[model samples]
Target: MIVTISDNNKNKTIEIKEKKLISTILSESGFSFSMPCGGKHICGKCKVFAKGNLSEPSLKEQSLLQHESKSDIRFACMTYVLGDTEIKLINKETEILTDGYFSQYDLNPSGINYGFAVDIGTTTVAVYGYDLKEGILMCKDSFLNPQSIYGTDVISRIQSSIDGNSKELQNVISDKIQKSILRLCDEYQININLVDNIVITGNTTMLYLLLNKNVRPLASAPFLIDDFLGRDVTASQCGFTHLNNANIYLPRTMSSFIGSDITCSVLAARDLIDDSKSTLLVDIGTNGEMTLFHNNQMLCCSTAAGPAFEGVGITMGVMAESGAINKVYLENNNIMYTTIKDKKPIGICGSGLVDSLAVFLSLGYIDESGYINIDKGEYITEYNGKHAISISDSGNSITQADVRAAQLAKAAICAGIYSLLNEVSLKPSDVDRLIIAGGFGSYIDVKNAAIIRMIPEELATKSIVVGNAAGAGASMILLSEKCRIENEETAKKAEIVDLSTSPYFMEKFVDCIMF
Candidate 1:
């Protein structure tokens, strides 16, 4: 049961017994990998390259590997352990630099008044432990979803559930989270029975996966969700009975695609805007969901931005994990980058794409319209063509095609912002603040985000990316009753704007692509 992860002198080992699956062992040992849809195998995430007989991959793993490479890579969640094995680990490229980002709150460390707030993202789960009285976070943990074998997008996973694998997918995610709660329960030396409660926020696909509900309706139009907004339920209902009837609170939702996760983000970010102010709250992911608050009312919508921003559906793209080329900086009029974990740059993440665009613009390489001049004579060579435009030199390296993919992704977000603003009877400059949510958004530089034309240029300084706002919002509900009621009310007051039905959406997407 000895497993080793090595990529040079760096080595870490994790031990597992005969009964443990390969997925559990990896997360237990703190190795970083993504299970973006809770290990359903649908997202083709939680991918790994193993050494030894355990390396032989499943058929589903083969298809996922086909997306990344033709070689013998495997899905860790789907891969079983016949024996001990060695696997290279892929952690996040950047550590959460907790600078002046979060306002320091005084937390009471006495006794055992703690709560767990969870953000169930399609790609990963984030758990935050908070001290009740002091109202400050103590520790945080995250892991990949085990149900990724089913599919990547929610629709595909819903289809997989139709074949009787649905319950299994639900168990994968619930079990992983249950164990994470227990781990925090033990690490903080707090009795699980005494812990306050737990809160969860995620898109409809995630909520249904946790509830083990039939999601067939969500996949097809009218695409109605049985219950978009949620109610307080016992731990047993969410398969968390192991915590002695822990209470689970979920945020309200608007639609099948636009779920409570975005609502939770809006609640957390509402403070970012003041009264007599016009602002927008954007939570971008595989589903680019957003809300606009103007004149004391809220209107919302969701755009099918797809997985391109999260590093899916690209030849050489990956989640924001280690070894991803995070930045392309101009030094001495030359472009150089530092990869995640300081290793050789392999693929690029969403933030990396934003940073790449910023660097290109800062050096006058790419125009404001996001077009890279293919004229070899127009730009100086960088690192001797290690990174080039209108050319190819490395495996899965950035190309003109990749630029267009990023364009589409950014266009969807930008277009959504503009459309939402227009509906509010205002222009981009009229907004007082623009708040960005999620770890991906928080990690990206705001000025760079605007320079690349992701948001309005005039509002660059006003934009703020709140790290794990969904998780933070859920954390607030875990401790306070006022926040819980407010969360549900927010969902009801929200006007779900269906951008998919908008005739102007296609036009906006095309227009944003030009810049």
Candidate 2:
């Protein structure tokens, strides 16, 4: 059968087999769609308009439609293609953030031939191919984590795994990585056969799920992990036959919450950690994982910042992709904004969301208590059937709930930072270097972040953006045995703190809810 997709006044035709859902057909046609609930008929972000022979909407879809109060709209994921159809996507295309902060270090790659350094994040995956013998990065690629269809956070993903979706999660991630490796090889004019090793870094749950390990241990109290130190396996064992001989190595984890991603990030910022300067390295996203080094001791903590910082669970929120608003500023009482790749604004990203809140707070459109002055109705717009302040003239907006989401996220992150400092008996001023690492960290305006009090104003001057520190650290390990050894030692020395159980954590988190 054939399916015609209408997007932005442009129509494209796609061919599909019988019994395929519109969501599956659009995915096969290379059209980007957000499946925040992982195609489970929940969250209801994957909306499309279909006019043709198609199966009836399921009870779930019907209920969702009624709740949305939109009769013409349908859930693409819930609608099956019974015959030829035309589908108009109501959801905007989402882009993934590939840029991040990585600390620069000396490398000696003469001992190695070729390898891959992969940073498997909850929302996105980044891979860097290195020609180790020449000490040069050959190619890099990144994409949205396909597992997002199941849910946006690690907990939801863990639930999916516990619900007997381990193989699906494993296959989706593995397939994406394998395909990325192949494309990287082809792009760099290098043969896949010459690649000798692959080093991967991710949070504990991500690495666990990628290998199809049980996640029940991570879901409840007394959380335990099967492997803190990842195992050595062949590419074939992970189902990648193209590099059958390649050694797939995953870095060790610090705790159930603190995974190899933090370990590798620590490796990237190794030089920045010394007695002369107390350093804090924070990779901000769904989980705001931070590591602080002072007097040769390392303290690590993970905060449940939620998916809001990554643009999930917000009305008109999107990932850091093309057409996503990445910046917002006020000029002569007029709002000025910029989007990623200079594309037309579709929605706000994590950085953009931060910028919007900061700008709104500065302009008095929003109150200190996170209230939007209803008197400023000129700046308020309707969004998803609710009132939201206009962040873009193109009808893109930030709702009160969006602000609340940001508040919850920033409160967790700031509280974690505060508790870490309190534990060390140091002030924000004591931090000589505050290295911001991760995709969100890369694009966020440090000034705006401080303005919103998401980050303490005291550290504004010391804050440094290091793009893709985890990926670069993975690359460093791939190129130099020294980096690998140092990371192992750092993992051993680093200590993990469970903030959820801390007595002072709840009090601090509540205190940080206001600007």
Candidate 3:
């Protein structure tokens, strides 16, 4: 079999004669399948199209094919052949990743100056527009993390770095981000050099890799950095743009995993965090970041919650994009969907996962112990008796395995919150306000989140979503010089919590695993 990834490097191709699992072949071929659920054939995310011999779908794949399988689309995880074949992969569709990755020299007062901000999150990137003169943002946009070439999660990227291919991984991802930035700049008809400053906020590892800094230390151990913050760099140096030379600002980081982005989250929510008697800022993304304020002290931590919540690390998980299922409902005792683009559903992403969990729990599809009754196959009705989870062109069912993946993710995140409460000797009821940051948290239903037990009931009661805090902080830095310094102080004051080494966290995770 000859498998090729479109648009990525061609030199990395491989020839496989043995009939190995699709994931095994892709993994060895230097192409990540991003099937976070260990390829159990339950999650229908590993879609692919073959161009050679034996191109028909397998029985396991026949069910998923009804939703998004054109003559071209096939589930990469299930499709296998006896002879040579050429396989094509699904390209991740992203939007507004960044704005040219450059800074403007001056403002155009009369017309929109079109200054841009980039938020380089571990899981995704968000771009925002602002008027140079008035220094007000026009709109905001976001997309999946272009660095998914390494793997779906930052830890996977770290593993890629550890394999002695760190530089190559960095270059490939950085180039993708740069191209996205250039496209945006060209579309807006603005000179890239005219952008005032390129302010980026990301976790330490992401920021380090973008800067082409050696991140070997971040893989394990004490997990420290050479510096906390940075302020000057040329766009061309980082492969962003050659159009301009701008002072790039990075917020000070509290620890190795927790970077300036958390501080930025605080900055964006300062209006609420500072005024409220007790506040919790939870920035959920690839890394589960949380900060709790009590009396006069601020405590923060980053949890290794994994990427199942955002549609990676699962068999059918995907980032939010066209054809990706975002919402599910119990329609006539069957699962129905609201896809992102009204297209045929290919796979389910984060929001869909949350919604599915809630629906299944309410409908008794999953037991109180989170055990999916695989024996009751009728409860798991197939779309036309096909194996896949969809009932219509773009609708699908949530597999028991998908529910389990969500269970693991929710457990980790909820455990972090529970541990935070334990440390303060308080309960979830003690928190006055809960501010959920990041693109994923912004649009999800707080009540639904509580019902599914993704979030505690008390915290969800007082919760509000603040979209893309990293972008918000970066926008503030582009507009105000003081924000940079304030971020440094914020990082210093935040107390760090290490969940990996905490036994309390393990217990909390176990308790939260049930539906």
Candidate 4:
């Protein structure tokens, strides 16, 4: 069987000897397709347009596809190609957040030639190439994390690893990063052999998967880890055969859930970690990792915020990409919105989701309890058998279930903030700065975020949008040996707060769920 895959107008044909899932064919063909639910027939997001010689949709696939308007659309994971088929992949141009702010540091290169700093995020991976001789950044690139095919969240990926996909996960990400680095070198007319040092940072599970370590620890209670990993290994050891001369340094992880990404974030935002005043640093994504620094003490916790904020789980959600609604507001007593690049609205992203919830609350379309009153507004319409607020003329809408998903996600973040504050015996007003770190955090409207109660309104004015601080921190670690030492020390000072066992967290979680 021959499968013709079309992505962004590019066509690639692959030969398959036997019938196989479209997802499998795509994966084997080196295409980036997200199966957030690990191909368990959940998420319903792996939609692709297919024609000719495909298996009939399963009952589960049919039910999931009911909300989809196009009859030709099929779930890539659920659909099988028995013969020659043409598949049009719905591959969006992702708007990855790469630029970040890092404090000035002394130049101290670990190697003589080129160096690369990588921030391996759950949803995306950013690579920064630098000139070790001149101590300047030469190039940078980012892509959707290929491991997303296994799942979207860290837990999901961990579960995938536990299901014996560890080697596969490691290979996909390793190969992607290696290729990304080589591409950067080729694009900039640099020698790949000269890339002598690489600094990589991510959550514990991400690093574990990168190293192909056992992930069963992260899947259960106690969440113990064998290797804390603030050490260096050869690129060849990490399967980066292209950069055989490079030494890959994995930053130290604070806890099983709170990974090196937070460590690097703190290092990047070191100025905010002042001793005189309290500061809270939050990287809100699939895992809501937060750090509170006050009086020389650091308290960190990880909350399972799920993938709602990243536009997963929501009825009509997407990554921050072209055509994605990235912002929403009220104009002339009417709901108004904007998409990335002013493209046609496909669905809402995290920032837009926050703004939408705030708009809905202010307009009284959503009650204090988060009920979407369909009778309250003309935009309210039924979608997938639930009340949804239409966001676009093309029929894209935020369903009631999406509101609940947003509530749960925001509540997890807000509750985690409160829990940290309660631990430090400080109120929201006491925090001098609420440093919002990460790609999603950088684009969000602080006012809308506070309006939705995702963060304390008091801290809204104090909020600092530090874009991609983790990547910046990773870059710092790559450029400075002192920064690397600080990264390790910062990890040591953090005291992990297990929210799963905290009654206060539970109490705050319940309260924050009210929106």
RMSD, each candidate, Å?
A: 5.6, 3.6, 6.2, 1.4
Name the candidate, 2 or 4, with the larger TM-score value. 4
Question: What is the per-residue lDDT of model 4 for residues 48-121, given as tens digits with 9 covering 90 to 100?
Answer: 99998999989998898777778789999998999999999887899898987798788887878899999999
Candidate 2 lDDT, 1-515, residue by residue in tens: 77889877557897766788777776665554567766776566777888788889888887777755455677878988888888887745455455554556567642357888899988878888888777777788887777776678899899989988888778778888988899888888878888888998999998888888778889997887767865576675565646775788888888899999988888887666666778998988899999988887799999999888667777777778678888899899788899988998877888899989998998888998899886785687776677789975856888888899899999998889988887889899889989998888877888888888777888889988777788878877777777777788888888777898987778888888888
Each candidate's TM vs. the true structure?
0.80, 0.89, 0.79, 0.97
lDDT of each: 0.69, 0.81, 0.68, 0.89
Best prediction by lDDT: 4
lDDT of 1 by residue, 1-515 (tens): 77777634457876666745566676555434455554655555566667665745567766556556435466777877767787765444434422112322223322247678888877778888777767767777786555654556666667778878777667778888888888887888867776766788888888887888878888777777667646776676676658654566777777888777777776666567676888788877777788888888898888877777677755456766677766656678665666677776667777777777777667666665666665534343332244345112223345555667788888888788888887867888898888887766776767777776677787788887786777766766676676777778888888877777776777877887765
Which ten contiguous residues of candidate 3 have the minimum total lDDT?
Answer: 99-108
Q: What lDDT score is found at residue 412 in candidate 3?
A: 79
lDDT of 4 at 51: 91
Error of 3 at 317 (Å): 2.9
Candidate 1, overall lDDT? 0.69
Model 3 lDDT tens row, 389-424: 332345456665666777888887888888887778
